[model samples]
Target chain A: MPSSSSVPFDYSADGFAVRDDVTSIHRVSWEKIARAGSHWTGPQRVEIARQARAARAARNDPPWSRDALPGAEGRLPETAVEAARTIGADAHRIDRAWAESMIEALGDAAYVELGSIVVTVSALDAFGEALGRGHEPLPDAIEDGTPDGARLDAATDIGAYIPMADPFPGPNVGRALSLVPEANTLFFSNVMAMYGGPSGSFFDLKWDGPLSRPQAELLAARVSALNECFY
Target chain B: MPAGEQIVGFGEAVVRGSEDLPAAREALRQALGEAGFLEACGIAGIFNGLVRNADFSGIPLDDAALHSSEDFRDKLGLNDFSGAKNSDLSRADASQAGEGLFPHKGQ
Candidate 1:
């Protein structure tokens, strides 16, 4: 058996240093998204992250049969709250019409940011849930920082709902999260570390790991199916 | 195809959280042992987030990806998914609609 010290995990790519306080991969990744992103304020980001968790918790509750549910008060914007609930409970329902409506209400940038928060929180929470550890608390929001608004990549319209930044030989997940670079960085960094490194070696038919690539792919495919995700 | 039954059952249990989870987990444990079984759960948890990211964003497969995965997607009936069917909206439309909503001040 390998000791804890022998395990390889790095977060330098996302500007995080190894720390004794940051024990789990999920906790550190949660800290990354708690910061202000390209569109939302830090407080707003944190609030949305909270709502994402709340939505996940409420997922198994009886469906709000009526069009309006009482006591839906939240710190995040109404549209953002709805987006979080939809994403957490059932992302498959996020069709073009719903996305368009959200963009109209929340603006393209904010909508993108909300989507980023939902995915980030869901990933972390799901990991914790699978391990029976539950969710880690949200870190303090980094206030007084403005969005960098960096659009360095010349994205191409590749039949997606949004333009995709060039990923070259990389998977569609990179391009999918490219609209918000900070989100992309946080998500991919965690994914790369947990699954395998960025070399894409883990995605092949045969690979060196405790789990074969086919077995890994099968788990991925099954989860995607359960989520009703076609990508 | 060697361990298809156990693998598929394990995957389903991981996603569904069904009552069969313990049995499925044990089957996978018997096949891949502890580390591999745990890794499978981790991968499943990862996709639980990843699939949402793609679906919520309405991201479509690039041309090459679309072409290559056609057979696999069809065989798996993935094309019938709601996200795939609803992903026809153009990015140009979204961008044009959001014009002036967020000033690209930093650009």
Candidate 2:
């Protein structure tokens, strides 16, 4: 991983007016991913990110026709690789039974963390691709540490795939990764930086960025439709 | 709403990563200017992850959102999505309208 001191991202050369706040948050996210998380180690988290990218690369292929991911190169197990692949490539098809099976094998917290990594990388990759910049490179070195195995005590089964922080005043989508606070934090950082209004508030219904709220929502709705996401 | 059509076209092209993205990107840039085009790209990118997070987590639509959206969910063909199974749409209160999306904000 780039040392904590190294700048992880610099969009200045991209020539487009990338927001400073957006750049800073992405750097922070990369820093966090390079370090150990609540469940997975730095190397394992990076590996999950790589696998997610690989899955996305093969998104057009049927799962059976895609080349198999290598076996257990990093600390991650084969099941972890599959979890990343499914969540990364075919999340629309993910159902309660498949999620339960993954959770049963990987444990709920680990599964949530893995899913968070997959989705976060997906967002980052998509951002670059949209900007015609392709993907930002994965971290060069993995920080050294073990999984903390920590989880929030307040989380409960909310009738979703796994437990989430309950009584959350925000939308269910906002609390989706609450089972693992780090994962939730990691992903939402990108959400806020990328989509939040000038004050970095997602609830700013009247948000008028360079793109008007309607324009932004139009794009968002179209993207969601393309992804086949109901929520 | 100015460039609404181009924004939708650009978003679709980006998300689908289609062969025509270059053409779509140029058209959106011409319609919305550089700042708007870049912002649109950013929004498109993030929603890709946001949608996955919701689907993989199996979280349902919040009650108010589920209800508020009743008028157009079917019209939009959203009900046909696989993730629609996660929410019990039958439980929505159709009588309730204009319930702001975050009905429980701060409380």
Candidate 3:
């Protein structure tokens, strides 16, 4: 396998013109996952990603029957392990009580960071899957460091399980990761690259892409439903 | 909704990892050339994360979206989804509907 630094979101071999920003954002996400974050160590983050992948692979199976990952026994706390698995395969069913319990054990910031890692890796892998590329190998080496415990102090509870940055001038989804600003940047940067384009056309009724706005929305809505997402 | 059928089929097949994905991908590529096919793939991939972000964070639906979607939310059974509980639909009013997607923007 190519070294993580050499690995990128390259589609040239596949004969597609993926935007430059999209490729860059995806590569950055991979690099970030291999390093220590606000609440989790590098290895912990990577392990969380692995558990998420494992859970998603068993998505067809009932959660009760899904095999336990090595996370709890080795690096991650049991609460974090459960958070990764549930977020990866069954986020649609995640409720406030369950989330609060996990947060109580892992701390709200840690839980949010873990969720971000799971979703980041899942999104990257899903793109590959959509194009028949299968999964990218996880980073072979993790950066060595202790977590900084940096968290958004001003974050306030907005009826969500955890505190979030004060109401922002955007969709609630855009503010979803605000408690961890880096997490918000990590995920939504990819979102903007992949969908919104340079002018932030997500709100625009007309689009100039090869796919029309409706065609794009059709794909987006269908995928959201297939995942059983309510939002 | 011209190419909606093909787009939806491709999305369902890909997300499910179904055996039909190969066939669905080919159909979508034919309908929307190579560029559109790729963009579609990216959209499918990102929404996987988008949904998780929203659900995991427990963000309620924007009021405008809630009010605008009210008519079909129940009929389409969207109100039954777990995340629907985040938003109180009883507060969805016509005044809310007038605001565009980013009601909080510039305020």
Candidate 4:
């Protein structure tokens, strides 16, 4: 039950910490999610991320399909590949039924792990593309041991596919990633750095940055609208 | 807010996986310089993931956020969004939008 304020800007748990020099918060977050998960190995997680990137790239291509790219033949589980692609390319379509089946097939932890990986990679790649820089190279996989398999709190139905832990009085985005603490922390650290540095200056509409706070909020709101995200 | 409007178009292009994203990027760069354009994209990219995570988790809006954002959300018709409805947590039919992934019973 660590309060949101207690999670340091450079927080790392269970042998997972991003390098401080990685000033690019997205890259830092990318490194964290690319690491091994509770069920998937680092390589497996990386592969899933790769597939998610490919899925996002292929989104504008004709004949929409959620298929993994050709090179990923048998490199990861089919369900895992599908989950990554779906979460990356069309996450708004993920209803409870889709999630329940994914959990039933992949186990709750793995499913959560896969969704986290997909969204992280998708976000990074999207940033790269928007910046007119190609996707960042996947960091070398760190061979961490098996996932610690720690479910810190009993999940209750939160109208999502899987039950969620108790709500913290923070942004729903943070709560969204709480089921897996590593993912939650990794994602938020990157967000905090990218948006406001250590000060969490997200709501300061006139703050200094390459883009003004209003400009940043504009981009954020538009993306959220496009994704149909309510929180 | 013309710049913001252009950014909305650029952000939508990036989020929707549009082929015109390069053009959109160029437009934003022209208006906001290279650094500003890059920052705009970076913010949009971060939200792409954040929004998805929130939608998937179905976490409700914080009471403060909901209260403060009521006017804006209403004006934007954000409440009409499927994800917004799902976040209510009290709606019995919230989870019934689509069929559950499991087809067979008790496999």
Q: What lDDT score belongs to each candidate, Candidate 1 first?
A: 0.65, 0.85, 0.81, 0.66
- C-alpha TM-score for every candidate: 0.76, 0.94, 0.93, 0.76
Which 10-residue span in candidate 2 chain B carries the lowest summed lDDT? Answer: B97-106
Candidate 2 global CA lDDT score = 0.85
Candidate 4 runs further than 4 Å off: A1-27, A61-68, A142-144, A154-157, A165-167, A197-207, B65-80, B89-107
Best by DockQ: 2
Q: Mind giving the per-residue lDDT tens digits that candidate 2 earns over A34-99?
A: 788998989888888888988986787899988665455756888898899998889999999999
User: Candidate 4 residues A89-134, lDDT tens each?
Assistant: 6676667677778788887767777777877777767765666555
The interface RMSD value for candidate 3 stands at 1.1
Error of 1 at B43 (Å): 0.5
Score candidate 3 by TM-score against the native.
0.93
* Candidate 3 clashing pairs, residues 3+ apart or interchain: none
Ranked by DockQ, top first: 2, 3, 4, 1
Give the distance in Å from residue A114's predicted Cα in candidate 3 to where it truly belongs.
0.6
Docking class of 3: high
Give a tens-digit lDDT track for model 1, residues A1-231: 112332222223222332222235556666666676788878788888777777766655555742333333555778888887787777877787888888788866577677778887787666545544445567678887887765436766665566667544555666676766776776666566456422343233235556667767777777788877887
What TM-score would you give candidate 2 relative to the actual structure?
0.94
Kindly indicate the candidate among 2 and 4 with the higher lDDT: 2
Write the residue-wise lDDT of candidate 3 on A25-131 in tens digits: 88788788888888888988889999998888777789888755444567888778889999999999999999989988998889889989888887888888888
Looking at candidate 1 chain B, the ten consecutive residues that score lowest on lDDT are B94-103
Clashing pairs in 4: A38-A147, A97-B100, A97-B101
